[model samples]
Target: MKSMPLKLALVAGLGLAFAGATTYAPPASAQVYVTQVGVAPPPPRFERVPPPRYGYVWAPGYWRWDGYRHRHVWVSGYWVHGRPGYVWHPAYWDHAPGGWRFRNGYWAR
Candidate 1:
């Protein structure tokens, strides 16, 4: 008799937890825009860094946001190891309502 009420409460608690988990808000979208000041200078020409192994790849340079200048700064080019089934997207600066925004480079598997 007492166990019946306890079992009902347990089921109701589990149901509420599952419902809350499924109702979580989705992540906000990435903002994209252009900014004149945030443009980065051309990357310096230099000898390419040797790949760690034969299959490694090079990820190119890009600009990053600098808060003090209200502009973007250059992050130099570098080599990265290639993953078996991934592609590297170079980083870039985008203007947004807030200010100049930087999107970091990433390897997409």
Candidate 2:
């Protein structure tokens, strides 16, 4: 009979402890939004282009996102006219907390 009262008190104590924990919410400053990682794009595409013409350089192929299908599609590489003192930077995908972000390649001097 005495043990029964002790058991009841133990259970009540534990219940109150848990209830107290959930009753309070963390402050906004303490909350952090985390982005989920996403599946990466498929393998790269291969294309054979003829020799560069008119000082054009080959910009490598890259993946493009298709919003309609919610997937990535291969964009064929093509020849672009070379800038006098710029370098061709290819497009690439970058990892973000919630998903992937596509960074467009550009001509960097």
Candidate 3:
């Protein structure tokens, strides 16, 4: 009989925990284009890093945040012909409270 009350209490506790976990508010999105002093200029242009001796296409350059400042960084794009039906999503930045956050580009099929 005593075990019944203990079991009920355990169930109630678990229900409260689950409810609290689901009620959490998500953090606000960060800012992406805030410029700070001492930020380094974009990296020098170089010959396109040839794609893997295959048919991969090259994507252009973009800016990225370097822990300290925003620096222009080139993420050499590649040709992905295997997935014929896929489309490339170019990389982008999101502004956050801290600084610019880079979202890596990806291929979508």
Candidate 4:
């Protein structure tokens, strides 16, 4: 029957997918420290603030490209607990010949 061949193809495709699942690497964006994708990401959107909290510092939102989706996603800013003697450095994208590379945020002492 025609359906028999279609079912076989579907099974084969699924088999291949499962077989390669373990070997799949994270998207190139995660591994790339820098990119020259050419176009600059849009400016970060505004974050609303509530009354100041005692010990939390603000982590500003920024855009990170979803390489798999081929689009920019907004990483929303949030409050992080303050570390004594350390300043939280927000993540930012730097432009180069290879486009913008993301610098991960960190607490710099």
TM-score of each: 0.45, 0.59, 0.36, 0.62
Indicate the TM-score of model 3: 0.36
Model 1 lowest lDDT segment of ten: 25-34
Best by TM-score: 4
- lDDT scores of the candidates, listed in order: 0.62, 0.71, 0.55, 0.74
lDDT of predicted model 1 = 0.62
Q: Ranking by TM-score, best first?
A: 4, 2, 1, 3
- Checking candidate 2 for backbone clashes, the offending pairs are 35-97, 35-98, 36-98
Give the Å shift of residue 11 in candidate 1: 63
Q: So what's the TM-score on candidate 2? A: 0.59
Better of 1 and 4 by lDDT: 4
Any runs in candidate 4 off by more than 4 Å, and if so which?
Answer: 1-36
Q: Which residue pairs in candidate 3 have backbone atoms (N, alpha carbon, C) closer than 3 angstroms, thus clashing?
A: 30-95, 30-96, 31-95, 31-96, 32-94, 32-95, 56-79, 57-79
Model 1 bad stretches (over 4 Å): 1-53, 66-71
Candidate 3 vs 4: which has more TM-score: 4
Residue-wise C-alpha lDDT for candidate 3, range 2-108, written one tens digit per residue: 99999999999999999898555333333223443344445435656664645344555556555544456555554444334555565565556555455665555
Best by lDDT: 4
